[model samples]
Target: MDLPAPLQWTEHVLFSLLLAVVVRSYVLYGLTGVLKDLVKFLRLLPGVDTLIQFILAREVQTFMNKVSATPVDSEPVKKAVEIPEKGCSAEELLQDMAELKALETVTEDGKVFAYVYTMEDEHAKTLRKAFDMFNDPTGYDGNDKPSARENVVNQFAHTFLHENALSPMVFPALRKMETEVISMVATMLNGDSRCSGSLTTGGTESILMAVKCYRDRARELMPHITEPEIVAPITIHPAFEKAAEYFNLTVCHAPLKPDFTVDLAAFEKLIGKNTVMLAASAPQYPYGIVDPIEDVGRLATKHNLPFHVDGCFGGFMLPWVEKLGYPVPPFDFRVQGVTSVSADVHKYGFGLKGSSVVVYKSSEIRRHQIFAYSSWPGGLFGSPGFSGTRPGANIAASWAALRSLGEDGYMQKAEQLMKTTLAMEEGVDSIQGLSIVGKPAMTAFAIMSTENSGIDILALADAMEARDWHMERQQLPNTLHCTIMPHHIGREMVFINDLTESADEVRGKASLSSKGTAGMYGMVAKIPDRAVVDEFILQFFDKAYKL
Candidate 1:
C-alpha cells in the first residue's frame, strides 16, 4: 500500500484525509454503516491496528475458553488429525470412543428442551429400523446389467435411504415417498387440491425456497421493478434475512405490538411497490405469540401480494390443538391470501430430523422454486431445493410419523402438551419477579422479569443452567424461552420450583463480597456496540470448529 519513494510524504496527507472522511461518516450514520469502511481504510495504520488486533485476540481467546460453553469435542472420535493407516474394526472403534458418547447431552429423560423431538423409545426404534433397512440394500450392483433380485423388493421403500433424490428418474420410490409426504402435509394444513411444494432439509431451507420463489416470480411478473424487498415482522426467523442477503433484496422489519405480535398497521405501511412478498409467523419461536395471520392475510389480499405463513413452530401442533377444543386461530391455507406455508416435521410432527415441507397454493407459483441447468458437461441438472443429495430416510420417516400418529395419536399428545403449556404459563406468571411475556397460543412461551423486579433474569438463567437445564436466552427485555412437549408432562412442577429458586438466588447476589463479572448470559443485551458483539460471536463460531 506504500507509494513511490518520492511520494512517501503525500501518503501521510492522503491517510489524514481518509481518516477525516471515515470519522465524519461514523458520526453521521453510526457504526453499522461505517464500521466495515473504517476497518478497510484504517488497517493501513500499522501501529494503531497492531494494538487493536492484540486486544481483540486476547478478548476472543477469553471469550472462547472462559465465557462460552464447553465445545462438543471431536478428538475422542479420531485417533489422529488424519485417517488412520490401518483402520480398526467397527465394534472396536465404537468401544474405544466412550469420551464422545459421554459428551452428548442426556436428553433421553427429556430434560433438554430444544434440538430434540423424541416421542417414545419404540417410536424412535421404528424410524431407525426403517432407515437401516433401506440404507445400502443389495438391490443395486455396479455391473453391465441390473441385479437379479431387483424385482423382489421393487414395491418396497426400495433402498431409498441410499438413493439420490437429485435424479428422481433413477429412484422412483424416493419420488413416490417424497410426493406422498408433501401431499400429506398439504392436506393437513388444509391446502386445496392445487397445493404443490418440495421437501426441504429443514425449516430454514423451506423459508429460503419460498423467498426465492417470490423473488423470481416478481422478476417475471413485474419486470420493471429493479430492487426487490421483503416485509415481515421483527419476530420472523433469521432465515428470511439470510434469503434477502443472498438474493439482493432489502428486508423491512415491522415492529411489534404490546402483545408481542407484529404491529399490523406498521406492517401494512412498510409494504410499498417494491415489496415482492409478505411473511408472518404462526407462533413465532421467541415468544410463541402467533401474529395476527388473518389480519395480515387481509392486507396481503388488499395489496394483491403473495403472503407466506411460517408455521414451522405451530404447524403440526396447532391443528391438533384446535381439534382439542383450544382457541387456535386460522394461520394456514384455510386462511385467505396465504400463498405459501412452511412447516417443520422435525419439530412437533415427531419425525426424524432435517425434514420439512414448504407448500404453495398452486403448482404455478411453486415452479419458480426449481433450478435447472442445460449446458453443463455433467449432464442435465435440476434440483427442487438447495440440497442435491437428500436423505430419503427423512422423507420416509416423516411419512411414517404422520401415518403412524394419525389424527388419534397426534390429538392425544396435543391435549397433554397443551395442558402442560397452559399449566406452566399459569405457574410461571404467578412467580414474584417473573411473568410470561404474552398470551402464548401454543406449546412454547417466554418468561421475562418484571419492570420493578429486583431479580437479574440472566443470573436466574445461569442458575437454571447450573441445574442441567439448557436455557435458550433471548433479548430485548431479556427473557428465557421454553418449548414444552409431551415429555414435559409431569416435570412442570419441578421446573417451576427450580425457576423460583433461581430467581431467589439472583435477587440475593447483589451483596457479593467482591465484585463479579457481568452475567455472560445477559451481557449481549447490555452491550450498545453491536459491532463488538458481532465480532465476539464471529470468534465464538470460529472456536466451535476447532474442537
Candidate 2:
C-alpha cells in the first residue's frame, strides 16, 4: 500500500479520499446483499408469522394500556411467591440452599445413573473453583469499557473474547488456547494437517454446525436442491433431527438391525439425489453399540457425501478402549469419507459441562459452518457457530481437565469404567430375566428382559426406582440404559443387589401392559402420526420449564 514518492500532498489527499469512498461503497453493497438475503430467509421461517403477529398484538396492547387507563374493580392479582426483603448471611444462605439441594434425586449415595457425571470430589471442587474465578467477567470485548478492561488481570487464564469477528485488541492468549483445543481434539480423531474445527457449547451445537455446513455446501454445489436431506440411523442422537427442523432440512431415518447397528442395505436405499450428508453414531447412546462406520464411510465415498460420526458420548473413551485391546471400528477422520467428527470433552474427556469440539476434514468445509456479515454499521461481523456470547470458563476448565488428567489418567478411568460395565453385564446376566442389550462397546449399556422370562423390563425399572435406584429407560427395545462412570466403580455390589431385588420384586407381575411412563412411551411409539408424539414431547418440555 506504499504511495508513489513523487506524489504531491494534494494528489495524496484526493487518492486517500477516493480509496475510502470505494471501500465504503463495496462494504455497503455487500451488506445490502446480505440484508436482502436475510430478509428472504426470515420470511421463510415458521416463526416469522408468529413474530409479526406478536408485534401487532403488542402494539395494540400498548395503545390500549395508554388510552384505556380506567382501572377495573377486581382485586389485584397476587404473586405466586414473594421474594425475601433482605439477603441472609452467608452461612444462613448456604444452610437454606442445602435444604433445597437435599431434594435432588442423586446425592452422596449416588443412586442416580444418568444426567450427572462426577469424578473425584477433588476434581469437582477444582472445576467449581475454576468456574467461580471467571463468573464475574464476561468474554465480551472490553476495549469499549476501560473499567472492565482494567479488571482483566489474567488475560490468559480468565476471559476469552468472543470468537465471532474477534476483536484484534482482545487477549490473544485465549484465542491461542482455543486453537490448541481444536488441534488436540483433531489429533485424537486421527486428523491430518488440513483438519480444522471449533469448540462448541455441547454436542448438540456441534451437530447443528455440521448440518449447517453440509446444507450450505450442498446449496453451493447444487443450487437446484431446495430441500436438502440428511441420511442417518434411527439410533442417531435426536440432535440431528433438531438441527434439520431448525435449518429446514429433511432427515431420513435408516432402520437398525437386531444388534442395534444400522442396516447398511436399508441405509443405502434412503440415500437419494437430495442427500447432503450421511451420519451415524459411534457407540450410539441408546444401546452403546458402535455403528458400522467403516462401511458407512465407504458408502459416503461412493456417493461423494460428507460423513459425520457423532462420538459425543464415546469419542474420548473409544480411543483408549481401542488401545486397551478392545475392538473399535474406524469412526473418525481415519475413515476416508468422514468429513467431520464431534467429540464432547464433557462426557468421557472428564472436562466441565458445556464443552465439545466439532472438527472438519479441512478448513475448506469449516468455512461453510461460519457466519459472516460485512455490512454492519459497527463493523464487519462473523461468528464460528450458533452463539455470540459463549462462556469462556468452560473452555478454560476443559483445557485444565485435559491437562490435569493426561493419557494415563484417562486410560485408568477407562479401565475402571470398562471393568464396571463388564461387571454390570455379568450382574444383569445373573438375574433370571434381565440381560445386557447388544455388545456394549463402551462404558454405556442397556439391560432388557429376556424373551424366555415373564418379567417386564419397564415394570422392573419402576421397581428399581421404588428401591431408590435411578435407571434410564429406552423405547426401541424396552431396555434400561445405564452409563458406567467413575462414581459407579465401587458401587457395583450395591447396584447388583438392588437390581436383583428389583427384578425379583417385579417378576411375573405384568404382561408388558405399559403402566406409568412405559404406557406413555408405548402409546407414543405406536402412534401413526409422529406429530402427535412431537406435540406431547413438546408439552412435556413445556412442563419442565414451569416453576
Candidate 1, residue 437: Cα displacement in angstroms equals: 1.1
Roughly what TM-score does model 1 have, to 2 decimal places?
0.71
Which whole-number lDDT from 0 to 100 does residue 94 have in model 2? 36
List, residue by residue over 490-513, the lDDT tens digit for candidate 1.
Answer: 888988898888787787575421
lDDT of 2: 0.73
Overall lDDT per candidate, in order of appearance: 0.74, 0.73
Runs in model 2 with CA error above 4 Å? Answer: 1-169, 511-514
Give candidates' CA RMSD values in order. Answer: 21.0, 18.4
lDDT of 2 at 234: 95
Candidates in order, TM-scores: namely 0.71, 0.72
Which residues of candidate 1, in runs, are more than 4 Å off? Answer: 1-159, 511-518
lDDT of 2 by residue, 79-159 (tens): 211112232233443343244223323223565333234544677668656655644332212122322221322231233
In model 2, residue pairs whose N, Cα or C atoms come closer than 3 Å (at least 3 residues apart or on different chains), thus clashing, are none
